[model samples]
Target: MTKNIKANGLNHLAISTNNMKEQIEFYTDVLGFRLVALYWMHGVEGCWHGFLEMNDSSQVAFVFNPANKDAKVEYGVTNPGHTGGPSAPGTMQHLAFNVDTLDDLLNMRDRIRSRGYNVMGPMDHGMCHSIYFQGPEDTCLEVATFGNADYPIGPKDWIDPEVQELAGISDEELAKFTNPIEFEGQGGTIPNPGYNPDSYNPDRPVQLLQGMFAMPDEQFAMIPMEKRPPSMMSDEDRAAKHAN
Candidate 1:
């Protein structure tokens, strides 16, 4: 049996940026994060650090090292231990936060744009609406809000302009709907713009054993057998099948 553990919440995430002052300004002035602490060490040589707080009390830290010399050094690089380099893809390129409403998200986008940074979207992602932009340190950042249904129920192949408009739908109206379909990929190929099935997999196998433990037997039985892999079956059946 796997032990159940609970995490209190995220404390903070630290990343290295080229320009500390501009990054701090972007996060505080544009994104609305509050600066909790700032540090500069004397003998540490070109090191500066700042901590920013989210509304939820979670924190993120930024570190600037001016004398590190390597231009390519950045957070999430293949050799992260190295002093300086560009961050590799699949690494931490950005951080995201959840917003309460689409209006709040758009307001943030406008604020960021007013600061002379290019802003993108209010894009629809089935379960959520999001806006993206680059921060002062060239770090990608996103602010999102739950808009449509709670989850993607089918292929994301029918994102219309109307859907984008619907993202700003009121909470009461959004509650009237159920099981929204999400567009796959990073908003799909052009012409269609936001339709990509490859972005989500609807057929991922279910773990029957874990389900049985987590839910009532009746609920487990109600799950489709085809969605359950053989390994999810009872130990008796697994042993019999393996013996054969």
Candidate 2:
């Protein structure tokens, strides 16, 4: 049987940084994100990791590998910055951060330009107003703002039925996708998937943290209930558990 799960919001997005210092400076100084934490990556040798907090739940994290110092990025492939293009499969194409208002989006455009970046558009993208720019490591970035859920940021007429048909979405399927049936939480333990990896789509992650995906079904179930990601643990509790 299929299970229903609800996710509140993004926790963070982690990306590899060729130059951690440059990434940190760009995000913290230029973009106005507060540097929350910088620490050695646990269990990894000669690596550094840090977080730039957008808010309590949202963050942009960077992982620096000194071992790959001389590696070259293939622009438009590995790195799709500079007015945006395409990236290799399994590579992150671009990242968009949310702003609260259209005024905020316009101000962000001015902010980017003031920093000497060739920023483009508060483009009217139907769903949101967005500004695009390039950042360190050829990372394509966008800032966007949308109206409240009750209001239509996009006109109903803007939705093209032909495109929907071309995408092979039937009216019923589209209805279901847009207005999904909400599932009430059981408020119990995470259920064992009881499935084989061979039957799963490798690209579709059932669960993820940062950029990492869920463990193998059997291995995931073996984890003690208290050690699960959702289980709350204090510093002392974690220390005691680790010492066990």
Candidate 3:
């Protein structure tokens, strides 16, 4: 009998960087991730590793190879003789994250700015507003907030055309439009494109944890539970636990 199979979600994403210290600073100080672990690997000369955890305990690892002494190497540069070598816009373009509120998104933008990094505005997407910044590793990152979850903004399709004409559509305005195809029953007069009326439901919360490295499933299975650190808990809960 197949044992009751419960699939666990993503544990973390790993990325190799030339400057580990900068990367750690960017993720921890600028992005608010907590540095959970750090260590050096044996038999791997000049290599170090660090792990960071988000508020939800989602983990990201950064591996540093100091032996690779090329400081000026940009992301797109590749070894000439190798075929299909590394490229800047390789398979992944960027990573996107969701925030709980518009204020949260703005606060993040401010935090990123405080680090002296240039960040793109809280641009409005059809269903969300986002801000973009480059991590210390030069990886493009985005933080977005679903318009429906915060603020008095209504769905995009529900907004009257006349109102749009009068107000002048901005990124903020566009981000307010929820996919009418997704959320249909909120009672605003948006035209439904034959979406399953009975099956229509509000969007559920989702967290996306993405990374550059892929580990073998067997290796993951071999990891002991005790070795895996507990996830990040809320400040109040953590204080209570410490008091106990």
- Ranked candidates, highest TM-score first: 2, 3, 1
What tens-digit string does per-residue lDDT give for candidate 1 at 1-244? 4333345578888877767778788789877789877765323444767888995669888878885446664456633332233467655655677778778888878888887877788888777887876655456677788745356433354444477467875545544443444434433223322323455433434464333345654664585333334346687865654454
Question: TM per model?
Answer: 0.50, 0.70, 0.50
Task: Report clash pairs, candidate 2.
Answer: none
The superposed Cα distance between candidate 1 and the true structure at residue 234, in angstroms, equals 67
Please name the candidate that would achieve the greatest lDDT relative to the true structure: 2
lDDT of 3 by residue, 65-136 (tens): 875566554555522111223554433356666678789999888988988988887876656788876665
Candidate 3, residue 195: CA error in Å?
44
As a TM-score, model 3 comes out at: 0.50
Better of 1 and 3 by lDDT: 1
Which candidate tops TM-score? 2
> Residues 60-174, candidate 2, lDDT per residue (tens digit)?
9999888667767887677765555777877888899888988787788887788888888878766677788888877888888874223455425455789989999998988
Superposed model 3: Cα runs more than 4 Å off: 1-9, 41-46, 70-92, 147-244
Select the stronger candidate by lDDT from 2 and 3: 2
Candidate 3: worst 10 consecutive residues by lDDT? 204-213
Once model 3 is optimally superposed onto the true structure by TM-score, how far is the C-alpha of residue 18 displaced, in angstroms?
A: 1.7
